[model samples]
Target: MPLPRPLAPTGRVAVVAPASAPLDPADAHAGLSVLRERGLRVETADPAGGPAAYLAGTDDARVAALNAALARDDLDALVCVRGGYGVLRILDRVDYAAARAHPKLVVGYSDVTALHLALWKEAGLPGVSGPMVASDWGVGLDAETEADFWRVVGGDAGYDVRGPGGEALTPLAPGEAEGVLLGGNLALVTALLGTPFLPDLTGAILFVEDVGEAPYRIDGMLARLRLAGVLGRLGGLVFGMFTGADVAPGRPTFSVDEVLAHYAPSVGGPVASGLVYGHVPRKSTLPVGVRARLTCGAEARLHVLDPVAA
Candidate 1:
């Protein structure tokens, strides 16, 4: 993974609704307040308004806001306020040249995965795809997740990521591997198939997480990756929190672990289980474009090899 440029205090950070719409005022207020309290300047393209069905506004409006922020001299970074849906609508609409020219941190996850891959593959900029302003920043973050966020953003070196000390942290393939970290929401990743946006995962550490999807859907998406020759190319794999996949009523099916074994034959890389990310209550912020080492031993640790830019 390439190192992210260091984020200094007083540096300006712009908030835009890249995926969903503008955030609810309450969520916005809390997130903005947190950013301000952390000693950074905060600006939003949405102001304090909500649009129809509430997406920062329209595709054009959201794109305009993001582009405007990119061009701004005061802003040092761009953070997505929330991620519900809508990024694909404006994928072609974004100005990659303008965004690359400015070169600032673009952060968010879920639907925002589309933007993360675009900014990296299209603009060649590294971005965080772990937490959203409305989700992680404003809300109270768990100690483990919070610590990991600052460690990465601050460019801390050689750290270990342990699972929530429980039986939940079981190995799938069991081994160690090093490669650039790449991946995000499972749905968004599969959706990018056959598009210019789907990144080349060759020799990359593919990390993925999702929320509220059935085990079969997760299996199907992984199957798609295998068919597309993605899984075969990865150097390593990490599975973040696969939340809300409880068995459906009257549906006797395989567990997430069972699904993992089903694809184990096709995956060539050393795979780890239970990463502390995804749509869970608290999660670490991850830079998708940075290279890192993933060790799956008694514990799972992702040691970032890229320096946080000085």
Candidate 2:
């Protein structure tokens, strides 16, 4: 595995919109300001054209901008502006050669998960599955979230995964396992099933999270993974926040917790929840493809075992 160079305090970062354009341009500007305030040089990659519907630009333009950023020798990192949609459409066209040749930290989540998985599969490059420029920084990150992001990308050796309030994770199954940390948004991970982009996650510590998915949908997705032999091959399993997945009042439905419990037995090893990651303001910056250890019992603990950056 190739770890990108750790970003320095004064490193240059390219901001690109590989998914959706910022709903408000002010958010983009504010996000850029945040980077500048951090004493980093920030540059925005302007695609050939303007937004095409919901996407930042046409597929060709978005891919071109992303490839250009990847090929840049000066940039220390590339951060997506936001994650709405469109990355899946241009996955095949991404310049994986550029990615391998110039491995740099790419940061984003949600729709960006597809890109992260594809890069890892095609280029053996690791990435920070953390906050987006416009989506998080523009809105302002909580202290913990901001600290976690910098700690990972800045080449911290390792750290314990803690909730926003510094609470320990809740244990779902009693055991321990260690492996490379993989996975991102639940929906995106599920969508990549059976695709060439989805990496072989055998013996890997998979962490997943999502927003707005109902309990039944969560159950179905888990079922699909179980049926596909995904859950059975895991070294361990961790669940982040499942936002907006609560059961409606007076409705017949299992809670997200119930759905997860139903599938806990399918995992090959330890199981845990409340990882303090996902589509939330206060989320951890996880380095995809890095080795990590998960311990679950009375107290759940996730310890990243490798520096994300060289």
Q: What is the C-alpha local distance difference test score of each model?
A: 0.75, 0.90
The segments of candidate 1 whose C-alpha lies over 4 angstroms from its true place after superposition are: 1-4, 47-50, 163-170, 297-300
The most accurate candidate by TM-score is 2
Tens digit of per-residue lDDT, candidate 2, span 63-82: 99999999988999999999
**Considering every candidate listed, which one attains the maximal lDDT?**
2
Per-residue lDDT of candidate 1, residues 182-228 (tens digit): 88888888899898987788888888888898899899999999999
- Backbone collision count in every prediction? 7, 0
Q: TM-score, each model?
A: 0.90, 0.97
Off by over 4 Å in 2: none
Task: Return the TM-score for candidate 1, rounded to 2 decimals.
Answer: 0.90
